[model samples]
Target: MLKLFFRHKWGPALLILLLAALVFFYNLGDISLWDPDEPRGAVIAHEMLQRGDWIHLSYNGHPVTDNPALVKPPLYYWSIALFSALQGHVDEFSARLPSALAGITTAILVFFLGARIFGTKTGFLGGLIFISNHMLFEQARSAEIDMTLTFLITAALFLFYHCYHEHYRPGWLYPAYAALGLAVLAKGPVGVIVPLMIAFLYLLARRDLKAIGKIKLPAGLLIILAVASPWFILEGRAFGAEFFFRQNFERFFHAFDHIQPWYYYFVKLPIHFLPWTLLLPAAVAYWFRRRKEKNPGRTFLLIWFIATFVFFSLSQSKRSLYIVPLYPALSLLVAEALERISSEQNLASLLPWIRGGAAFFALLLVTAGGTAAWLAATRFHDLARPVALLVAAALAGAALLYRMIRKGEGRGIVTAFLVCAFGLELLMAGVVYPSIDVKSRSS
Candidate 1:
């Protein structure tokens, strides 16, 4: 079964999506809605279904306010409501279904986009990395709008990239524009703003400024207006301009909450990105050494990462999840690096760092398991069985990965890392979250 993935082009894609589905949909409804965001979204969708009012946003039976619950556009609320309606009721599962679907779609998108730019193997690895991304794992299982927004942004970027490369007819631009428009509905102007900025920068970098003319800016704007304006206009008429200013403009310039130092992502991103994060520096260096080559794929990915990172870093309101859309670009780059190393490309110097990274993560996982074991022994006695099982799994994975790294087996190393990631996510879904739920209820 595993051999088929290496032997066939389509096998990896199928396997990746299946793995993503298992990780994402497993025990999705077991936990209660998390505080603030989850319950807020579920309850609002419930109310919207009851009131049959989709346009105007509200929470807890009150008119929408500038609070986090009512700050964004209604697309996510509409999604939850739609899913709930189909499911006959809104629970954790129904509330989070949209995000799970989006997460899965995003995983496949990463795979296809990577395959488009790199190759099938790199694409498969990239998709595997994305599915195991800690942020994606958490958000996909929750009722947050970030995953859905990330999906829209990723789709918009991927479609626009295809349009730019003429991989599709000019007609492709329309759906790309529609995606941008829907993204606006998902969040706000930033949804449209970020992608357009990245696209413009990419064109400018390529010195193909004339390509901008082909984008049909005027018609595209109209499409965006047609798709995103109805709810904003209706809501504006009902609530005036206050919500718009506060939610969009004010939040960016002078965020009332979640304000962080400019360098917040500098620290946060590396942590959330995990074992793959260590590979990023090597991937970047490899790309830099090859900068003289005119690789549009590499250029566009670098721009996507830089533009998204700088854009969010500059914003006053920042959360780690705000950069979820950037993970695909990162994953593709890391996958390219891994692929090159496996093929013995000019990235020989990077091999040591890659091995070191695997070893480091193996040690980290072992350490984490030990910590959990300690806590189980000295503190949470009730969680001893699951904790011990997790610890054993962690140790076994760590030992296997370390062996792969020592043997200098590039493909084995990647496979082992992914297998460990899958195991960790399984443990997380099967044990950790449920344990947290139990503790939350007990407390």
Candidate 2:
């Protein structure tokens, strides 16, 4: 079994493991929904189900009239509502199931796009990085529209990348635009605006204005209207003209959520890309350095990443998950960097700092695991020694893998990344979830 698994292509097997892990962790906890946002979102869907008034969102048996027009579109909430109606009551699993599934599906789409645009190795690395992201996992297990919006926007991005690379088929641009329209429904105008801005900039950068013209704008616009118009029309009829103008247009301009400086995203970027953050500068430099090589795929992805960063940076409201769509691009860039470094005979001399940095992180993980076990034993005696032993074993395994890679293992650095991420995910799903469950029950 082990030989067969190892013989199979690593990408598909890794993806299957990721999906299975996500599904398992997703089902581990009890039905206690997280507070302030997740449960609130679920309740909105539940109220919608009860009242049958999709346009006006209600909370706690009263009309939530504070800033009508549905606040956010109803894609995620509607999905939860449908699921809850079937199940008789919305639980944590039911509310969060859609986002979890969407997250996994998004990873699959990234794999396909990455493979087509770059190579199979790049795709595998990209998918592993995305699924291993702590923020992505957290959002997947919570009831939020952000993950759904990210999924739609990413789908649109995948289609758009293909459309640009392979001559724009009339059929391709339509679905691409249609996905963007659904993104709008999932979040707001940022969906349509972000992709359009990125594509325009990408074409302009490539000096491919003629290719842009082949998009069949009229048909694409109609597709967008077809997918996105009904909700806007219904909401406008239910509310007033202010629904469109204030909620859609003015909100962007006036900083409706909370205004932050232009440098807000700059501050948050490191935390958003934790563990992988150290390698981003090298990745970005590698991307621009290779641009003159006329690599359309890398160029397009870089443009997508930069455009999204700039767009959200300038937005009045900002959040970490807003940048989730950009991670795939970053992952690709990182993978490219790793591949380039690996190919060079003097790789050890060139990237001594990176190698040391990775070793440090691996050591840190081991230290943190030991510290956590000590705390559990001393402060929280309720935790079983068996669980602590499992966690320690996993951490030790990760550290050993890191050491082996440092010593020039048979597998490459990409494999090291895969093993580390896979170990961390297993630790979370296996050891951490059980710990959380025990604490919840005792409380």
lDDT of 1 by residue, 235-292 (tens): 8754436556776688789998899999999999988887678666667767777779
In candidate 2, how many Å is residue 281 off?
A: 5.0
Using all chains and alpha carbons, the TM-scores for the candidates as numbered come to 0.96, 0.86
Listing every candidate in turn, what is its Cα RMSD in Å to the true structure after a full C-alpha superposition? 1.8, 3.6
Q: Write the per-residue lDDT of candidate 2 for residues 227-251, one digit (tens) a residue.
A: 8888777765543345556665675
Model 1 ranges off by over 4 Å = 1-9, 66-69, 238-240
Task: Give all candidates' CA lDDT scores.
Answer: 0.85, 0.69
As a TM-score, model 2 comes out at 0.86
Model 1 C-alpha lDDT versus the unseen true structure? 0.85
